[model samples]
Target chain A: MDHGQIEATNLIDRYLTNRATPEECARFEEHFLDCPDCLSRLESTRGLIDGLKQQPPDTFQRRTWVGFMGWIAAAAVTTFAIFRPPPATPPPVTIPGPTLTARAGPVFTLATVRGAQADAPIVTVSGEFTLALDFEPAPGIKGFAVQVTSGTGEQLMSEVEHPLSASGTIGIGLRSQDLKPGLYRAVVVGKSVDGRELQRVIFPFRFQVP
Target chain B: MQSSGTGQSFASPRRSRQDLVSAIVSGDRSAEAELVDWFARGLAIILSRIVKDHQTVEDLRQDSFRIAIERLRSGALRDPDALPGFMAMIARNVAIEHLRQRTPGALSATAPDPTGGPSQYHDLARKQNAAIVRKILNELPQPRDRELLYRFYIADEEKETICERFGLSALHFNRVLHRARERFRELFEKRRSGGGIVPPLDAPDR
Candidate 1:
C-alpha cells in the first residue's frame, strides 16, 4: 500500500478503537468521505472487530448455553416463520408500530374545519388553512416525514423533511378542497440520513366542508 | 429525559419481571403499561449506544417493547427470565434490520435477514463461525492476553480495573490492546476470507 493509504488505514483503526487523536480523527473523517477505498477498509475493519466482540465468549469455546441459545434462536425463527404471511396476502388491519411521543403539545386546530362544515357538518370546506404539528427535531436526524392518511389508512398527502420551525415544529398549509370530509390521520416520522424511520407520531383529526 | 405515558418515573422500580410477563400474557393492559414504563429508559439507553440519533433511538425503543410484547403474547418466549435478554436481542435486531434495509449491499452475505424464514443452514453457519472465532482466541498462548481481550472488549470492564489486573500503565495497556485487537483482526480476516465466512459490520447508526 502507498504511504498515504497505509496512514489512512492506521487512522481508521485507531478511530474505531478510540485511540485516535482528535486531529487524526478529523483528517481521517475528511479523507474517508472522499475516498471509497479507505471507506471500504474502514467498513470491513469495523465488521471484523464488531463481529468478534458480539459472539458470546462461552459460545466461542465449549459451553452449555450454546445448545440453549440454539434452541432459542430456533424458536425465534419458528415464531417469525409461523407469524409472517405469504407475500401475496395482506393483513386485515395495519396496526401502527410503536413510536416515540412528540416532544411538544398539539398546537394546530381544526377550527376552520369545524367552522366551514357547521352548516353541512359532513362535507369538507373548500379553502386553505395553516396546519401545524409540534415536535422537537431530534439530533442527527436529517429530516421528518409528514403524511396524511384516511382513517381507513389511505395515504392522501405525504412530504419528506418538511422544515422544522426554530421552536421545533412543522407547519404546512392545507387546502380543504383537496381533502374530503370525514376522519383523517396525520403522521410524522423522523428519519435519519440513510432514510431509516426513527420516531413516528400520529394525529387523528376530522375534516368537514360546507 | 423522555417521559413515557405513565406519570411515574421512566425508571421506576418494578414488580418481578416474571410476574410482569405473566400478567401481560394473561391480558392485563395495565401490567403491559407498567412494563413499558419500566423498560422505556433502559431500552433507550441500550439503543442509543448503537443508534446515535435520539429520534431513531426513541423509535427503536418503542419497537423493542412492541416486539417483546408481541412475542410474549404469542408464546414466543418459553422462559420468563429470558425476557430482558430477549428484549435486548429484539432491539439489536431492529437496529440491524434498519441498517440492512438502507444498504443491502453494505452488509455481508451471511447477515441475518430481519424477516427471514427458519433455515438450518443459517444455524450451521453461525455455529461454524463461532467455533472459528473461538479457535483463534484459544491460540493466543498467553492467559493474560486472552483475559485482557475478554475483559476489555467482551466484558466491557472498566479501563482502570483492566490495567490493574494486567500490571500495566493505562498508556501501555492501550498499546497492548491495539496490538491485540490487530492480531484478532488478522486472524478473523484470514478465517473469513479463506472460509468464505462473512464478518458482520453492522453498527446501529450513530
Candidate 2:
C-alpha cells in the first residue's frame, strides 16, 4: 500500500476501535466515500473485526475452512447478508378480469404540497430562464402533472411526468417570446393513481419579451 | 415586462466551492442559491446522524450553511480545501446545539458529547450485526492473525506490544496488518455482493 493508503488504514483502525476523534472520523468519512481503494481496505478491516469475534475458545474446536473454497463460501455468506438488494417496487394495481385500476387521494392539495415542500424543498427561480417547477410529493403521490398559465388564467403549457432535476426543480421551456413577456405562474400539480391531485404549488415569475 | 431586475441572474451548477464562498460573501443571489443547492445534500447527511426529525435536519442544514457563509465572509476559514470537513463540522455543531435546545439535558445518543461515555448511539449495533462480524471472523486464514486482531480489538492491546509479539518492526507490522485487513475486506465484499470468491492473499497454510 502507498503511504496515503496506509495512513487511511490506520485511521480506519482507529475509527473501528472507537479511538478516532470527531474531526478524524469526519475526515475519514469524507475520504472513504470518494476513495474506492480505501473502501476496499476498510472492508477487509471490518472483516478482521468480524472474524475475530467468531473464534472458539478451544484450539481443537477452532475449525479451519479447507483451502480457499471455505474462505470463498464465507465471503459469499457475509457479503450477501450485509448488502441486501433494495426492495422491488410493487406491481401496478389492476383488477383481474376487466383490468380496472383505482387510485385514492385528491387531485392536488395545497396542504399536502406544503408538507412535502418542507421535506424535499421547492427550489424557486429568478431571472429570465425556462420556468422550472419541482417539489417533493406528499406521501403516495406517484407522479406530477404541471401546468403554466398567464395572470389572466390562460393555460399556456401543460405537461405530464416532467422530469424533476436532482435539485428538485421541473423545467418548462417558456422563453420570453412564449408569453408576451409578462408575469406568469407555473402551477405544479401532484398526482397519485387515477390522475388524482395530491397537492398543487404556484410559482410566479416575470419575463420580458426579447 | 421588466428587463434584468435585481433578482435577475442565470442559475449555474458549475460554480466551484471557492466561487460559491466568494459569491455568497459578496451577496450574489444566484451564487447563494447555488451554494444551498450544492451543500444541502451533504449537510443533510451529516445532520441526519444526530437529528432524526427530517424537518429539524433540513432546518439545521440551512442554519449550518448560513453560519458557514457568514464565517467565510468574516475570514474565519483560511483554507478552501478544508471546506467540506469544515462545513460538516459546522453542521454537526448545529445539530448538537439543536438537541441541547430541545431536550435541555437529553443529548443525542448518536454523537459525541462533552460528558462522553457511550451517550451517543455511535457504533452501538444490535446483535444481528455482531453475529455477522463473528461469522466473517471464522474465515480468517491465520489463527495468530485472528488472535492478534482479537487482542487489539476486544482485548484492546497496545500497538507496541502487538508489534513485539509478532516479532516485526512497528512499520512492518502496520503493513502486515494493512494486508490482513485488505484481504478480509475482499472476502467480505465478495461474499456480500454474492460474487464467487477467489484465493485469499493471506490464507493460512493448513
Best by DockQ: 2
- Every model's DockQ: 0.03, 0.08
For all predicted structures, in order, the TM-scores are 0.31, 0.36
lDDT by residue (A1-210, candidate 1, tens digit) is 233555534555455543454455444443333233454556445543444443552322321122223334455665874454333321111111122111111113221211112221223322333345433334445466788888788878876455322223355446656777788766777677678876666656666543
CAPRI-wise, candidate 1 is incorrect
Worst 10 residues of 1 chain B by lDDT: B1-10
Q: Mind sharing the TM-score for model 1? A: 0.31
Task: Assess the local accuracy of residue B137 in candidate 1 as a C-alpha lDDT between 0 and 100.
Answer: 60
Report lDDT per candidate.
0.49, 0.47
Candidate 1 C-alpha lDDT tens digits along B1-206: 12122223223535666677788889888888986865554454345434434456667778888888888888787876555556666765786666545443221212233333323544444445455545656665544555555444433334576687447787766665556556545665776778765433323211
Worst 10 residues of 1 chain A by lDDT: A98-107
lDDT of 2 by residue, A33-120 (tens): 3334554555455445544433333321222111122334445675873354322322222212111111100001111212222211
Q: Give TM-scores of the second chain, every candidate.
A: 0.47, 0.44
